[model samples]
Target: MGFLLNNRVGHLLIAIMLFVAVVAVLLLIAKVADGLRGKARMPAVIAVFAGPALLMLAVGLIYPFIRTVWMSFMDARSQNFIGFDNYVTALTADASVIAFRNTFLWVILTPLLSTTIGLVYAVLIDQSRLEKAAKALLFLPMAISFVGAGIIWRFVYDYKGAGQDQIGVINALLNSVGLAPVRFLQDAPGNTIFLILVLVWIEAGFAMVILSAAIKAVPVDIIEAARLDGANSWELFRNITVPSIRPSLVVVLTTISIATLKIFDITRTMTGAQFDTQVLANQMYDQSFVFGNNGLGSAMAVFIFLLVVPLVVFNVRQMAKNREVRG
Candidate 1:
């Protein structure tokens, strides 16, 4: 018998393996289900609870993290060890430096804008007659993928030369008002900020949903008590509402911060990190895949990972503390 071991056949073999594994899991689940009503079922329950998740975590997260760390120390071929040379280069190189600055800008701007806008919108819409509808409308953008939103906003910011009719909404408006068309994507700092606006637009809806829920969860009695004590609207919002939702606010802020750290889609789709808009994640992609500098890309990836870790850890601790307080 002849055997096929080519690419297509290899993929078929992998698919077959997956199908078998899934079938085995189904059989095991069936067996577990049959034993569910047993008196002493702790072991079966334990397996049901932890088995697949542990296996997936080991295969997916832990393995990839170990692989990435190993890659960081390896050359482009991923064979030769390069010690700290890549790290040092990333820290000092001009492109990497720009990427670092842009990443900091993204980290600062996107979260602040998204969270603040969301909180404000939530506050404004809360208790209003059309609150749900207003919230749904505002939060609709969050349903769009980052790339989709980027493409949408790309058209909005599109511009044409002086005699050509402007196709971009912003430029069209400017032209209607007898103003010059601005190159939204070519401008340095402004372009970066414009890209950030897309992230903010996408994330604001998420922030709004979370913050609105937090607002609703605030005790009515506390607000009534504050109102009776002559707490003005601003005072009630500041002293009562905000304080009550402090934990949620922190969660929103830090969650968005982490998302901002890994921002790549908007940059990649909008400008491809051109004109000084390159953030760390996009820079990593460019370094590795575009420039064929795997070492530099890996180092950038490591840096992004390092930058995100503290934020994630802090967010987790805050969440834990919040849970403790609630408990």
Candidate 2:
């Protein structure tokens, strides 16, 4: 099995066989279902189709979640029940405190700044002749992976000592003006802000695309009616445009908030979670894989899960409310 997995041709053959076997099993189930009558056939088919999916879900998501929660209460080696000690360490330890604070900053600032910038951009470019081209320029960053964006921005914020030739864009500009070069990623607290800026630059494009569609979907008839009633641009935007796109705004905020909560790549890529810039996900990775402290890692994972649940629930409820209003 190891040799087959190691060989590319053998691996491809195994994958092809697995795919063929799954198709064959489904076809066999269909053929068997055809032999049964209506009432029996429907349920038999449903069971056949849903059983594998439910089993996979249980093995993949449900089992790991339960295991992680259980491990959160165990000793580092999983040989003893520590019972809340790991949670205490995760929540109150100095490093954990800093991670939590940085995560809090990320959750608060990234969504608000990204959404606001995107919405303003969307409104400005709405129905303009250069709208498509302008939006394409902004949204291009969305195509870049988080790690790629971090690498790109690292060059932008790169630092060298005074009187040295600077390669970083920001430092180079500072040098041209005789301003001293600053260490953007080495400074504490402020370094976290610079890391968050990378995520914002990437997510703003996503926010713009969603909010732009929402703005354009606002009824033209409603806008004309408001204009006829002597509503100025600001009044129309504040009263009509915003309300019309409230659901999209909620979605963009919550989606970005969730993404921000799980942010790992930017921190790991640029600073390796150094210089007081670690967030929950980065902390979790460090504890689990780097430090080999499973209990504390699981505790951090559980904490992040707790924070994300409310945002996900609110997003779902808001979407349902929007659907009902549309219905």
Candidate 3:
């Protein structure tokens, strides 16, 4: 088995297997398409089938993830042999430490702010006449990609010197209010907050949609009973609404947390990891491609994988628990 998996013959055999798999899928799809043309509405049913899509997923996503993990343990050029020295350097190195700190701060802030704002919006918008419109407006930001959002916000944070025409929204407003035009993305703490606001703006909508659905899924009978028992709005929400949607809350938290851990685009686009706004993912890109320090980059990648895996597992377990509860 080892010989089969390790040699040139093994590579050739794997390629052959993959080729056969693709041909078989294409043949099956062609047959399905032909059969569907003879029967109206059956095509829709066939479209929903995910077997072929899963094969693509296995090759595209799962394979690459496994390959990255393997490479993390290997040497810089992905040849030669090295042990845990990369991991050790990642933990203790100056650049890595800075990246780790920034990522930790993002992890702490992003999920909390996004989830809190989303939950509040969800609660307020539930069953309201303006629910659809409010959700549409809030969720509009989610439609924008990270790069687009960063570009938009770049103007928002644009700094101008004394008495010059302030092009940035923030500086314009500050000047109008008789306040100094603050450098929003120049300072350390300020730049971090500015970047965080972009993420919160994008992710809050996701949180709101998921949480709103969860809120609606709360049993009406339970809410009515609580109200009838003289429970106030807060009490009813706490006792009846929140507990019912606790699982969705957990899911949203973990999802946002995972997203936060992999936050690269905003930092990369807005700050270029400058002004001490660097996070783990951006640092990994910089170390690997920009700086050509593959060892450090792989270490950062491994660290991100480690951080995300536990949260993902926890989310899965929470989902299973929810399923069991429902059952």
Candidate 4:
């Protein structure tokens, strides 16, 4: 059994057997449901379908969340109750303080910059001759995984000491212009800004795609009516286009904000959370896994969850309000 579990062919066979077992059980459930009376049949069928899903959710999501919250109040070894000490350390520790500051910078800058750039680009290319090509070109970066994008940009920002042959595109350009190469990843404060730019670049395409659809969905008749009323370009956009797509704007902004808040890949791949570029997610991972400080890590996780809940709640409320307005 151990050998079978370790072998590739055995793994495939085991997966196939599990799949077959699940199908047989589902079939048996359906047969039993069919034999039952009206009320019993409906309830049994519902239970057959929903029971596994609910069980999985309880085990996978709810249990882990509860465990993490419980651990957040315990000591590093989870052997003793430490109360709010871990939370205090997470908030007040020098590394954690820098992590929080950098996370704030990411949350603020990535969403706004990506959305603004995407909105402008979408507007500029809407109904244009090369709209498809232009959008495809802009969106190509989005196809790359965050790690891949980080590696690509690492080359773009790579630096070497003075009087050395520069291989990085940005540094090479600088060298060509008689300017010294800048250590974009190694520099503090500003390195965080450069890292934020990578996320913006990758997310801008997503923002443009969403906002473009929203812009196109605006009522053409309303646009014509506004134009006939002597509304100029800026007026039409400000009073018409912006208001019409406000819900989409909210969605794009909040979605990107949530994603930015949970940022891990770019920081991990590009800088390894070094040079004060650590965000909450990376810090949580390092504390819990690398340093074996589960208490502090869980505290960071809970703090992130707290920060995210408000954004998610706001987004849902806006979506519901939009639905009511449309209805």
> Which scores higher on TM-score, 1 or 2?
2
> Residues 96-174, candidate 2, lDDT per residue (tens digit)?
9999999999999999999999999999999899999999999999999998999999999999888899999999999
The C-alpha RMSD of each candidate to the native structure, in angstroms, is: 3.4, 2.5, 8.4, 2.6
Question: For model 4, how does the per-residue alpha-carbon lDDT over 1-327 read when each residue is reduced to its tens digit?
Answer: 877657978778898998798778878898899899977899779868986798779989999999999999999999999899999999999999999999999999999999999999999999999999999988889999999999999999988888999999999999999999999999899999999999999999999999999999999999999999999988988999999999999999999999999999999999999999999999999999999999999999999999999999999998898789779
lDDT of 1 at 192: 89
Candidate 3: list runs displaced more than 4 Å. Answer: 1-21, 24-63, 73-75
Best by TM-score: 2
User: What is candidate 3's lDDT per residue for 106-169, written digit by digit as tens?
Assistant: 8888888999999999998899999999999999999999999999999999999979889999
Native-vs-model 2 lDDT? Answer: 0.93
Which residue pairs collide, candidate 3?
Answer: none
| Candidate 2 pairs with clashing backbones | none
Model 4, global lDDT: 0.94
Compute the lDDT of residue 163 as modeled in candidate 1.
Answer: 87
Clashing residue pairs in candidate 4 (N, C-alpha, C atoms within 3 angstroms): none
Candidate 1 residues 194-259, lDDT tens each? 998999988999999999999999999999999999999899889999999999999999999999
Q: In lDDT terms, which candidate is top? A: 4
Candidate 4 least-lDDT 10 residues = 2-11
What TM-score would you give candidate 2 relative to the actual structure?
A: 0.92
| Model 1, runs deviating above 4 Å | 1-6, 18-49
**In candidate 1, what residue range of length 10 has the lowest lDDT sum?**
1-10
